[model samples]
Target: MHLSVENLTFGYGSKPILKGVRIDGIGAGKVAAIIGPNAAGKSTLFKCLAGILKGTGNIFYDGRPIEAFRREEITKHVTYLPQEGASNAVLTVFEAILLARQFSVSWRVSDDDLVTVSETMEALEIADFALRYLNELSGGQRQMVSIAQALVRNPDVLLMDEPTNSLDLQRQLEVLSIVRKATKAKGMTTLIALHDLNLASRYADQFVVMSDGMVYASGRAESVLTPQMLEDIYGVHAEVSIDSHGQTVVTPMCSARNRIANRRPEYAQLAV
Candidate 1:
């Protein structure tokens, strides 16, 4: 499946957050990273795509406009994972995951449903927490369970906002690797909103850089993550280089203001 957004516009009551955002060429089995500074509308865009927040323009999935689909119909093809994993529900981890598949399963859940939930938990290495209450688990543990819920749905399109917010370095890599593998194995079109540029560079097959309320850049990592793009979008002086493994590495030196102040002493006061 291919996903495309054209002239998408959304905002709060009177304040516009996204203006004429356009992104194209997100193919199946590919992971696309949406990177931008805070309040740049990355999360809003994901919400719009997930049908949680209705926008003005068009969102196409495999050439069909998404607006035509009903909520249940959309749920069959799309699953959304939010930034935070905090749940006020008193349900256990196993029950929460089983509930996620309730939409697709018949009235009474069968043994197959239980087995599927179990396998998904094992895949995420969260089987030990199956009986634990969602509110009682740590933030990282909850985040892992949230991902397991999404994966259990087996959607064709997976939309995640800041999926690695509370994970440590090791867990971050493990989660992203699992997501990547799942996307390819299921031929799912995955869009993730992320703040870590290095992680985005490492896993994303395509990069969509948002700035202000528009798409600042969109393409492969090498083409989109240039030093100039970093300075323009993030206001940071960064070095973009390829590592021994041919992966893009972004090393941020300092703020753009500081870099300018150091180069020209006369403008040093402006940095403050």
Candidate 2:
């Protein structure tokens, strides 16, 4: 159930995105969140862990290197919920969910398969729309169905790629909470690529912050999500504060000068 990433590095052709990144340890039953600004190679890191992309270093799950594992074998142990790009085509929600089980058979669906399908549809609260098509459902519902597809495999680890994009606040919280609860209840390890640091602080047990093609910071959510870290990763000045209800709210102030005045001394240049 453990995931170990060692000296991992990747790139497109000329520009390197990850440089000797290594996360050699994670407990069996924890939620690790990866956060960084846009184009920080967050998705690329997730792909490396999921074996969707090739990297230079060794990634071990339990004990074996993930690079040595076949695609089917990888899929059996790790479930990756890709971004919502697949919905650009025309497929129904129910069709998409059913297609998730394509690795099983060609002609028929077994009793156990049907049971899994039924439970997934119900657990994701998409049971009533079981007959609905993809284009027919809202963006939020489509995201939910996409998550359901990933869970159908029930792998040892679930990796998500900005799964909350294009979602409203309510739906975002709902889906994120669902992922946290479901993964913990099932005793599976989960790693989510997140753009929202406040949300990560609220739910994630651990955080990996990426900057300049490398891990700039990592550890618990509180340690990794300081105001300086946000400004260093993003050019914007933002305040990370907790409300009376103990919810983290990220307030981004537009003026660069103010952030310069407020940031810590070591990261004073973040004002620009």
Candidate that scores best on lDDT: 1
Top TM-score model:
1
lDDT of each: 0.90, 0.79
List model 1 lDDT by residue over 166-206, tens digit each. 99999899999999999999999999999998898889999
lDDT of 2 by residue, 81-134 (tens): 878534645776666776777664454766776788788888777889887777
Clashing pairs in 2: 92-133, 92-134, 93-133, 93-134
TM-score of each: 0.95, 0.86
| Stretches > 4 Å off in candidate 1 | 104-106, 264-272
**lDDT score of model 1?**
0.90
How does residue 11 of candidate 1 score in lDDT? 85
Model 1 worst lDDT window (10 residues) = 101-110
Off by over 4 Å in 2: 88-91, 104-108, 242-249, 255-272
In candidate 1 the C-alpha lDDT for residue 49 amounts to 89
